[model samples]
Target: MGPLRDFRPPRGILVASSITAAAVTYLAALGRLELLTTGNFASSQQVTAGADLQVANLRPAAEQQQQQHQQHQQQAHQQQQPSGIDTGLALSRLEFEKAGAYPQVTSQRAAAGIDDGVVAPQQQQQQQQRLVFEEKLQELASAADREDEVAHSRLLWERRWQQLWPGQAWGSEPKCQEWQASIRPRDFRSTWVEERLRGLPAQSGVEIGACQLRVSMPDNVQMRYVDKSADAEFLKSQCFAKDGAQRPDIVDDATRLALIEDESFDLLVAAHVLEHMQDVLGTLRHWLRVVKKGGLVFLALPDLCDFKYPFGDRLRLVATPAHFVEEFQDQNASRRNFEGHVLEQGVSVAGIDSLRAASGLPALNRTGNLEDLESITRNFVAMNADADRLTTKMTVPLNLAYSTMEHFGSYCEDHPHNVHFHLWTRNSMHGMLSAATELFRPLGLTFVVEELHTAGRTEYNMQELRVALRRTG
Candidate 1:
């Protein structure tokens, strides 16, 4: 067959090819056959050269991907819970747990009460008038970025509320107000006291840095780290210590000891510092030490019992005042300049009375206890301008410097009287003064009233000063 152009395969080889085709067809018919029934070819199984082995390798990866997707979905579902709702619920529960109504109150919280509710409409109206002394306080505190002033204000307000309204109060209710006249203002026996704070002449000879502890003037403009221009007249006279040794160190609340020498200060003026102190007696003792026997300490503070900030109602609420006067020089403040004080609560008065009784001021329990404040007026507390950090950068202000006069003028008027944890009445003032005197008396300290230029909170017609006599053995 002429080497037949198309050679016919041997029957055996042909049959083998046909059988192979048939096998291929059969395998195709059973497409994607897997060794196991789990819809995946097992990757661990060894296989001859076939597509099944390739698919098996991919199956494991596919299954892993599906599992990962499911896990991701589950995790996502758990993340969508509301955290705020849970936190709010917890806070609400706590508030309710502490909620109280008409509980006996002390300090500023006493303003919220409902005992003997009968009162005159006009009187209530007068009591409702709000006085925000904190505006000025914030201005002063913000002036130097001092947060303590605001904190002190909160304390002052709380005690003030309690002192004005001595009764049961709710914890969360609005505090009610009482007429100024309702809580009769405690009058001092002007004629009974022998000592009086004498006003300083506008142009009196003054020298403050001759003593060992050099006098530090105020720094109102530079409190924020940037020095702002001040009155040229005031700035020109400033005696800048070469090392600024007289300035307060920001690191410690006290003056840097090394920087100070003997007899640096003949006068120490702090405004509204006494109110925030916990241990007034101890503080006074230390003050006596810091002062050079004859050096004077100028002070200014609020009388919550004499001002009306009916903080809240019902729940022995705390009206954290701008400050609290745990101890002070006196309770008798003039009502001419400052108004709307509410010192009705009796705790402060009692404390003051007790203190006066304990002291042998001689004038205590005298006729001066029941008269106008003109002769023997006093504010509730004193302040520390640099209380937070001891820094000479802080400064006093003109308005603050005149606090004594302004407060005295308002005090001479019909300022509302309120409550306080501790009120600084004439008796209390006498006690504090007596305590300070006792500590300083041994050092031969003399009390001489002078004019102060401090700004934080003190402003008055008179300031006290002490001069050290020649040291005795």
Candidate 2:
């Protein structure tokens, strides 16, 4: 009965005595169960450091025998045994079975805050906190993946856009920098119109071709409307309409503005007007002449590649600074320019079949009117006869036929038509203006570029290229 000595008993008592010795040794390693004979509980360091280290290393192998031990304990607990059965051995084995559930040793399990099959309160709380942390980490990784996808898609779109429209990469040339009036380019929309007008030290201004009053004028300023063909009846019949029923104050050629005195107005406003003029530079000179010194000339014109809502001239090649200068040189460029516009309109807007029928050619008339369409399509065959001989296409094909330019020139002169005479973009327009200063300098016409703004796509793709100039001389 000593704690450390082996005792031999009778054959029936031998089994109980051996079982008791094994149970006591196992519990002692746990540093929990006390030995009554030893008078003290086993110390943790003593079990780990002593020669009984083999007992501490038996957990994995012991767990495999747990089921057999559990069955034996159940039978022992239910049935009554003889006095020599050693009840302490059965109870100790049951306690060891319950505590051995942890994957590691009993002492290590206690330090880690785990117990039996049920986790300790502290350990359960830590597991829940770990789960929450793992969930948050997964969410952050998912968000990062989504952001990466968006960034990659955006980069692809930008590259595709750059390939499609090369002209979009404008306003960055060394010379263009000289014309840069703003630290950052501003959107020159209708809303921007009023804000600029209010800031001007202007009282008198004339709005040429004020078809649609896109912006409200300042109450302090006196505004006058002047259109080339402002007959209300004529305007109503045209494809475009005016803002309201208000008529123009003066009806005259916007390019000439003959009635308007030199240096008479403080400001001249023209929206969708400058592109129609034949002599781009000369027209600008005339506009400058009409405005007083320190006067503002505000212009809003459409870009040639206005993909949104384009006109008949959308397909035409953008007129370059050199082309504009060439036009400025020709004294009678108006007649040819007008004829070009009529041909472009007849084919693009009025349709090739409509033009053929309007001209009494062997084709069905699709458009209702003949007289108006005829004027545009008249001499279409004669001007493009070479093209007809070259190509047998049924469509009324048109090309830049300089050999027949004289034929259409005479026709357009006698029978006038409304069309866009010039096609330009923001960059080309800036280049044209830059060229104009040098070309017109000898002509005693000098002006300073006050501002340049490019409006983003609005009203379904219609972009505006606006410019403000102050007449210096």
Candidate 3:
């Protein structure tokens, strides 16, 4: 049976097997064709996967670079910016930072392809408003500082005023009758003098050249007197000598004043005496030495600008011209003629040092001859004529003879007579006192002018300036 089993298959079975094999081969071939036909789709899917992986790898680096660029831009902007309070750079920075305030600036930046990186318009406006508020705050601080300085100055001025006037009002009417009772010739009473006396404290005092009157000292107040003359005959010749009386209690030699103790007197009254001294500063130093600290020194002088002589209505004449003529004329006169004023010119703040230096010049011994006298007279006549012509233009008779006689009698006299050396206005006197204090401060002398008054020339009064000074040291 095993030998007989090796026989061939049936034809139909072989045909079925062949058909199956062919179907399998055909399916394999169809699969290869499908793959060749869709080759691009497969390749694309693979490429897409690779691209996704590459993107994931580069993302962190790109984000880091962008962050670095943004940081660089922010740093550059901060470096270019200016501080709020930098005055020198504030204007330009304001224009740059608040560019939105000006429409043209925005347009210019946009045209130039430069982005300022400002925030929205609303936010920029808010930032601009904040800067303006800060500037206003700075201005207010400056104003406050100035106001404080002004307030301090005002306080200092008030304190000085209080020290000067004390209990009395600045321009108050004084008790003239009590102070002027002893002064003879009521026509010579001065309101300024009365005011000065009334302001003085009631204390021990001394008077230089007390001809007949003891000024406003109370009955209890003690006083020592000084004068240039001790002789009875000379005392009787005084203008205030009513009954040819002599003052036996007075000490002579007013220049030295050796009898008075240093810093002993509380008040020093030199009504019209200082102008006659040869060394005015030396006399003032001596007088200051005798007066105590915080004591008063009352001075009264004739106002040079207000001439009381009868000059027929020359109202159009400039005051400066007449003043210059008088000053130069006195300067040319001989020193022996003590009748001539040594300092006839008005004292001023600007001229104090020059005047003091001039006072040191050697006194000339030569007397004025006839020619000098004639020269002065002729100059005076010419000045009077010019003044008359400029002012009135009237054919009024010029009293040239009387004027020349009066001038010669006053300054060119042979004998030594009382004559005003220096003249003063209220401002000039104040300046003089201030200049003197500054000049003499090194000598431990501190003089302060407390009050100054100038009386007007009325029918009954003579123009004069009265000053009150206090010795602080």
Candidate 4:
């Protein structure tokens, strides 16, 4: 039994099995596998019959008949005239062709096309406007398709871009997505980001995102360049864009995900987003592991908490005694309890300032001086004082019974059929950064350097601090 000989199937049985497998594969290829075992073909026959009776059965059948009659009339006219040339057909064909060939309108595209950077009066103004509208529709379509924040952010960018340029057009056309997500690098102020290039001590190379750089000469081009650009248009944009702001290696989460599992980017940019994360520490640890020694991570989060919530139907809103709303504080678990809301998943956003300081990221990486905590808090207060915006004004009127003035945090949780998991404030953000400096001090992953950035509605708060952080081993 230990070394038993294997038995083979009979010739006839083998042939039958092969035939069945082949038939199954063939039917599957034709997308008719269900027809093999079930009366699916018969069901299709019923649908086919209904389609045939489209001219006879439904109310639309009358319209179909009229269309057939019109087609017959058109054929009759074509038959009556011996010429193949049809001016009407030519115009219709041209329009259909134009629909696909025409580039879509985005702010930059529109700006590029317009005279004096404004919509020019043209007979095709209507067509251009339609293109702009389609661009908006396309963005919404993209948003609907994506479940994660990455694509959502793109739509946010699209909305903001559209607002900036009303009749803008997109040079690139986005089609139905193929993957779960793609990587996007945060915008770099200067292409020349200083980095200690791996393998070369004290050597720094300017890094550029895939969007801003192109590689040429196939034999000499790099794999990174290949992933960045494949077509001439992409190559041109990445290569020829103005301002020689030293291109740097810019990679997004999805791209980095392909490179490393359970890892975060060396250069992380949090733009009003860190507050959304339930566990800031867990996320921080993940990024710290993969980032090269001396590489930078950046953070920029909203200081306000009026727009966050939990994740379920039972998620209820709680009232807090304060001017601030108790939106899900990724730092605080229970809306009512400051401690329960502390961590979402395994990450904690507490003590960011101490974490950075403990790790070694001092603002004085350039200035060569350590930032004291008192100075940090004063800076945080100053930043908040300059960056804060009051959004207590509701755009839509709410009944007094439903409205909770100071307890507006419930608004985010109650509306949209779910509650957020965290609420962040300028105090919390600076506090978390400040806190992480102490909390992360024991964890061995500390920030060596930091750059601060704050950005929001230009009308509300123009004070945007973009922080780039270097990790000290």
TM-score per candidate, chains pooled: 0.24, 0.47, 0.40, 0.28
Q: In model 3, where is the ten-residue run with the lowest total lDDT?
A: 1-10
Residue range 1-473, candidate 3, lDDT tens digits: 00001010001111110112222222222122232222111122332233233323334644465345446645978766322222212222232233322211123234335544668976654554444434433442343334332222211111112111110111111212222223323233334445445545567888777665445455545777777667766664442243543253556566667777789888787765664554455567678888899887876655433322112111111122222232324553234323223112111111221212222322122234422434333433333333212221111111112222233333323322333334444554555555567656888888777877655443423444566889999
The deviation in Å at residue 315 for candidate 1 is: 15
Alpha carbon lDDT at 152, candidate 4: 30
* RMSD after CA superposition, every candidate: 37.0, 37.6, 46.3, 27.5
Could you give candidate 2's per-residue lDDT for residues 63-177 as a string of tens digits? 4464465566569777754221122222333333444321111232343455445677667554543333333223323423343322222121111121111111111111222
Global CA lDDT computed for model 4? 0.30
Residue 125, model 2, lDDT: 51
* Local accuracy of candidate 1 as per-residue lDDT tens digits, 1-473: 00010011100011110112222221222222222111122121111123232223334644465345445645877765423222222222222122311111222211334323456854443233211122322332332233332222222222222112222121111111222233322322111110222332221111212111222233211111101123333222221212222222222222122323433444343323343333344444444344454444444434332222111111122322111222222233222102222221222222222222222111122233223222122212111111122211111111111122222223223322111222243223543454555444565553432321111112221111111222111
Poorest 10 consecutive residues by lDDT, candidate 4: 1-10
* Candidate number that wins on TM-score, 1 or 4: 4
Q: Which candidate achieves the best TM-score against the true structure?
A: 2
Every candidate's lDDT: 0.25, 0.46, 0.39, 0.30
lDDT of 1 at 302: 40
lDDT against true structure, model 3:
0.39
Cα miss at 93, model 1 (Å)? 35
